[model samples]
Target: MKPIRIVCGTRESRQDFSTKTALGRSLLIHEAANPVDLMLFAENKQGLSSIYNRAIDEAKEDPAILVFVHDDVHLCDFSWSERLREAVETFDVIGLAGNTRRLAGQPAWAFVDDRFTWDEKRYLSGIVGHGSSFPCNVSNFGPVPQACKLLDGLFLAADSERLWEANVRFDEQFEFHFYDMDFCRSAELGGLSMGTWPLSVVHESGGAFGTPMWRESYRRYQAKYAEGGEPTPQETSVQKQTPVHQFHNPDLLKLMPTNAKRVVEIGCSSGALAREYKKLNPDVHYIGIEIDPSYAQLAREHCDRVLDMNIETVSAQLLAEDLAADCWVFGDVLEHLYDPWQLLQKIREASAPGSCVVACIPNAQHWSVQARLSVGDFRYEDSGLFDRTHIRWFTLVTMLELFTQAGLTVEAGVPRVFDEPQRERFLPAIHAMAAAAGRDPEMAVQDALPLQYVFRAVVS
Candidate 1:
C-alpha cells in the first residue's frame, strides 16, 4: 500500500508557540507507510480558513489528508497517525468528537437544549484539560469508530483529493467560529461521510458563547447558510437598519388580551412599541423598565412609570411597588440577560394572579441561521435578531421549556410570519436541511420557518 501523506496546519501566537503540546508529540511518531508534512503559520494572523486554504495552495506534495489543529490540543494517543490512515480509507472527514443525531434548530452538534431530555451520547470521546497536562474528564459519545452528523473542530483530518474533486471549499468567510461544523457539513452535503478516530486529545478552554464577536461570526454563518422560514421584518438591508432609535414589535400587543388593564415592559427603549400599542388601546397602563436613561426618560410620556435600570438587576419590589400588571412584556429581552432563566422564575414569582409573561424572542435556529450554518458563516450586527447586545439565545422549543421551568404554562403563541419574498429566499436551504433530517420537507418547512416565537406564558 502507498504511504499516507499527512499535512498539518496549526494556529498559534508566535509567543505561545514556545512549546509543543500532545498534537506535536503525536505527529512526531512516524510510520514507514505514512510521511507527515507540517505547516504552522508563524502567528495565526490569517483566520483558520485562510490558513488552511493557503496550506492547500502551498503544498508541494499531494497529501491524502490535511490536518487542522489548535496549538493547545494534546494528541496523547501515539497511534493517532495509524488511526488517521485507517479512518481516511473509509471516511472523508475525521474528528475526535461528534454527534450521530442532530436535533432541529440547534446551532451545533455540541449544543444541546437542557429543557428537552437529550441523548447525552453527543460526545464521541475527547478530553478537556485545565492548566495541567492531565485531562479532567473523558467526553464520550460511545466507543468509536462512530459516524456522526457533526464533529468538534479541535482536531480535523480531511480527505484532500475527495474534497478537491467535489469542489468543496472550506468557507473563508467564517473566522474562528463554526468552521469545523461548517467544513464537516459542507463535506457531508457533498456526499462525504465523517467518523471519529479514538485518538487521545484534550482541549484547553471551553468556548465563550454569546459574545458580540461570536454572535457576529455566528450571524454571518447563519446569513450565508441559514435561510428560509418566516424571515423577520427586522431581517433587512444595513442601509434600512442604520440610524434606528427604537424597536417595538406589534406582535407583543397581539399576545395581550383586550382586557389587560396593566402591562409592564422590560427593555422598553423609548416605548416605541408602546405608542403603537396605545394607539389601538390607550386605556392600558404601561410601566417601562429601560437600561438607557435617555430612552427611559422618553418612555415617561407613553408610560404610567418608567424606571432606568438594567433588567439583570431588576427586583420584584420594583415591579410590585408601582403596579400589579395584567401581563409583563419582554418584547425582546430574554436573550440579552446574564441569567434569563432565573429572571423568568423571578418574574413568575413576583407577578399577581391572572398575570402572564409575554415575550418576543428571536429563534436562534431560524431557517436563516441554519442555512448560513449549513454553508458556515455567522455575522453579528449592531441590531436585528442577532443584535450584538443579545447575550442569550433560544429556539421555539427551548423558549416554551423556559416558561414551563419558570412555573408558567404556555397560554398561546403568535409567530412573526415571513413575507412571501422572504419565504421564497429561505425555502431551498430549509428544504435541504429537512431532507437531511429525514423529515417531510413541507412539514419541516412549516415547523422551522417561524422567525420569532411571540408567546403568552401564564403562571401554572
Candidate 2:
C-alpha cells in the first residue's frame, strides 16, 4: 500500500513551525505513529491551487494517497492514515465533510445558494471537529462515506496517479475561496468519483466567508461556472422549497409602549404580532392592514379590525380614525414600500404626542449583503435581507434619518444580530479594508454586525 503524502501550506516559517502552528505540531507527534512524506510550504504567498499543483506535478511518478490540507488543522485520529488508505481505494477523491448535491449559484460546498444558505441536512454528509484542542465541538452534518458532488476544501485526499491520469487540476484564479468547489466540479466533470470519509481532525479557523476577498473570488467562480448550464437538481430542489415568511418578531413587540390601548400594524400577515400582543393587552384594539385578502381574513381572528387593502392606498383620513394609537408597528415592512418617506409623513399626521412608531427594518450594511453585492449577486430570495418584494434598503444612519426627517423623535434603536464563527473571521478583512479607506475599524465592524434594527420613535 502507498503511504500517505501530506501537502500543506502555512504563513509560519520553518523555524516557528512546531512551536507556533497546529499542523506542524500534529505532524511532529503523529509522524512517529504512522510515517509519511511531507511537503510543507512555509511563509507561502502563492494561491493554494498553485501550491497543490506543484506538489501534484512533483509526485507524478510516485503512486501515493496525496492529502491537501490547511495549516490550521490538527490530525487527531490515530488511524487517520489507515483510514485514508482505505478511503482512496473506494473513491477517487475523498474529503472529511461535503454536500451530496450541487446548486447552480452555490458559493460554497455546504451552501445551496449564494445567500450562504446551508443545504438541507439530509443532502449533507460527514462530521468534523472544530476548536484548538482535541476534545472540540463536532459539527455532525450527517453519515460519512457517502457519495458527494461537492467537498470541503479544508481536508481533501486523492491518489496522485488517478488525479494525474484524469487531468484534473485546481483553477489558479481562485486564490483562496471557492477553490474547493471548483476542484470538485472539475473532478466530477472528469468522471472522478468523490465522497466524504470519517476522519478525526480539529480545525482551528472556521472559514472567512463574508469578507471582501472572499466575495471577489466568488465573482470569479460564478463567471467560470455559471455561464451555460440548465438548472441543476439542487437548483430545482431549492426552487421547490420557496421559504414562507409569516413569523412575528418579538423585538418589535417589545418596542411597543405598554400604556398604549390602540395599535395598528402594517403588512400584518395573519396578524401574528397582533395575536401575541393581544395576549398581553386584551383591551388593546389591534387593526391590521393586509393586501392579501386571505391573510386579512386570517388576521381578523386575532385583530379587532382587518383592512383588506394596501396601506399605500389608504387615505390619511381613514388612517387618522385610529388616531392617537399607542403603537404603529411596521415589522419588516418599510423597505417594501415605493415611498416609505411619504407613508411616514402620513403616519406622523395620524399620531398624537407620545405615540410611538416601532419598526423592524433589515440592514443593507450587513456583511452578508455586502458580500453578495461584492460578488454581483443581487438575486432576490423569497424572504431574507434580499426579499424580492423589497423596493428600498437602509443602513442604521439612513434609517435614523428617515425617522427624524418625518417629524418623529428617535428614542432608541436596538440591533438584532446573530453572530457565527465565520462572521467573526470576516472582521479582520473588514479591518484591513477600513485601514485602506481611512475609516475607523471599530465603526466599520459596528456597521457590519447587525442583520436588522428595531427602532422606537415618538411623535414629539
The candidate maximizing TM-score is: 2
Give candidate 2 misplaced runs (Cα > 4 Å). 227-234, 238-460
lDDT to native, each model: 0.66, 0.81
**Global local distance difference test of model 2:** 0.81
After TM-score superposition, the amount by which residue 107's alpha carbon in candidate 1 deviates from its true location, in angstroms, is: 40
Report the error of model 1 at residue 367, Å: 1.8
- Please give the lDDT score at residue 70 for candidate 1: 74
| Model 2 lDDT tens row, 1-460 | 6768888888999788877888888888888787888888999999999999988898787777889999898888887788888898899999999987665667788875656778889989998889998568999999989988799999999999999877788889987888898899768645578999998888999999978999888877766543212334323432211132456788988888866788888878778888889878888978786655556667877887765444564446545653336788998889976678988888898777888899999999888887778779999888888887677999998999999889999898899988556777677777788889998988988899999999999888
Worst 10 residues of 1 by lDDT: 233-242
- Per-model tally of clashing residue pairs: 25, 0
C-alpha positional error of residue 403 in candidate 1 after TM-score superposition, expressed in Å = 0.9
